[model samples]
Target: METRIDEIGPGIYRLSTYVADIAPPAGFTFNQFLLLGDEPLLFHTGLRRMFPGIHAAMARVMDPARLRWITFGHVEADECGAMNEWLRVAPQAQVAHGRTGCFVSLNDLADRAPRPLADGETIDLGNGKRVSYLDTPHVPHGWEAGLFFEESSGTLLCGDLFTQLGNGSTLTDGDIVGPAIAAEDMFRSSSLNPNMGATIRRLADLQPQRLALMHGPSFEGDAAAALMALAADYDQRLKAA
Candidate 1:
């Protein structure tokens, strides 16, 4: 397991861990995003077992204990499995997620209460950086699934939307659409929700410059066009299935 941290956006850092020889043929990558600001928010805590690595990675840049907000798109183990562990280290930090996630899981599981945000609510990270929450139910997987977009950086902290196979790289401008479609075919991780297309289009309309993914690598390119391509492919794939 090799863990590293790299700056993707201006002050946004991506903490990634690559696990070779996973069940999949291409291996896997677990990523977490840390944005430096007045409040200092961290998106996705990776798996609970990766806490030490994640902690060590953050220590290289900033104090992990000083993090104020621990947020995620959904309630999956890879997403919030380490919520309590993070709250244990950062006493001042609060668990944050979409209202659905908080009501469905975090309210009962988390050691600390969660700051639930409405569909369009925004959380100020200070230093002119703020995150606007988008309630994307079952777009990728979870019923409480949602995502966040940074206003200053135009980066969408999209969780599992464009999941690619293999531990590719830190970021890429090439075609991830093909790899993501292949993964979707193999894993069937995407949802069968009727509103899936609408949800995808919503994220595309945001016109994100960077996509902070959880699995595989991050992306820097025309997110809207990529999203549209995925949406169209997904529809065709679903029909074939």
Candidate 2:
């Protein structure tokens, strides 16, 4: 599997790897986002086995050792399986996540101590690139789940929010909510709690211009509307449940 790199937003690069064997027929894509700045940050470490390809893909744009912050949506293999690997390579990099994530897993899992972020906390990457973290406990899955929003580019580094199957375009303005719902039906990946819709609606309030998704193609244009639609779907699902 070859990892493809694309700049989904200003200073934000997406490294996508498509594996055909995972889901058969259509396959699945594991994506990671690299945000460059004075202090470069990498969201999602992919899998530990995928480090080589993702590392090479990242080196094409910037040195992997330059990474300053390592983070993910939650404590999952696909989300942060290569966390220690990254810390080993980028000596200066620290794992930053919500306080619960750090306390529950990262404190013992990380090779080095991690920096705990409070809800709505912002990390300045310098060069006008700032990312704010918001706790989204169990919205998607894990109690430690969270996401980041890049202020400068209006890009939301959404983790597993709009997860869809197949390796589609690197970026699209088309319908992602539909594909995401289909995937949700197939995998039942989300937590599906009453607060799920409300938490997602909170993200919609960000009015993100771009959504940097973890599983499928990154989306551009009318992100808030797409988010609302997804929220509505979750609400309906909760009612059905």
Candidate 3:
């Protein structure tokens, strides 16, 4: 698979999966990430089917076998389907889980130990770059979820948050590619599931500049305000209901 990579910010690139032709649901197609750091971190694996693209994208930064950490928010296939592959390629890479629950679940799946991460945990990516974990369980789906904010660049690696439909070339919230529409669609999808609103509240309080979605472009601007809008809107809906 020939993946299209776009540099969304310094050291960050949006990797477009070649499988868009197969028509995956929103937040389920590809991955957006930063790879030029000393110890690069990948937020999500596109899918089992997109491992080739994922692999190729990683190779662009270094040998696919050299990544130090493979971090993920959830245990879903789209988020972690390529775990075995990553373990195969990057033998020394540790699987970073947002919570102890996630570490246990993933251990059961891959028969490999996981590096448990909690809120406020920080992984040094070297060269003054580090990604801090912010636990936000059940935002889109519950199962030990969290977001990573790259301290050096101020980019929030939000998983399954601020996602949208369509496979566009540019990937960022400030790209005029439809942040409000995407935010509403994301709210609607997550609202159908219980417990996600709590995560939204946490995100509102933990503000970041960029909201990088796995399936679509990253959302930029005042992330705190954007997240507050989401949290407030969701709260109002629940009250009305």
Rank candidates by lDDT, best first: 2, 1, 3
Candidate lDDT values, in order: 0.88, 0.95, 0.69
Error of 1 at 161 (Å): 1.0
lDDT of 2 by residue, 24-86 (tens): 799999999999999999999989999999999999999999999999999999999999999
Candidate 2 is scored at a TM of 0.99
Cα error, residue 232 of model 3, in Å, equals 2.2
Error of 3 at 86 (Å): 0.7
lDDT of 2 at 225: 98
lDDT by residue for model 3 (1-241), tens: 5676777778777777645444345333466475566777777766777788767866776676667788877778888888878888787787888665555587677646878887899999887788888876666555576778887677778777666566654644454324544555545655333455666767666657777778666667788777766666556656766
Question: Higher lDDT: candidate 1 or 2?
Answer: 2
Model 1: ten consecutive residues of lowest lDDT: 19-28
Ranking by TM-score: 2, 1, 3
TM-score of 3: 0.84
Give per-candidate clash totals: 0, 0, 2
- In candidate 3 the C-alpha lDDT for residue 232 amounts to 61
Worst 10-residue lDDT window for candidate 3 reads 20-29
Candidate whose TM-score is highest: 2
RMSD of each: 1.1, 0.6, 3.2
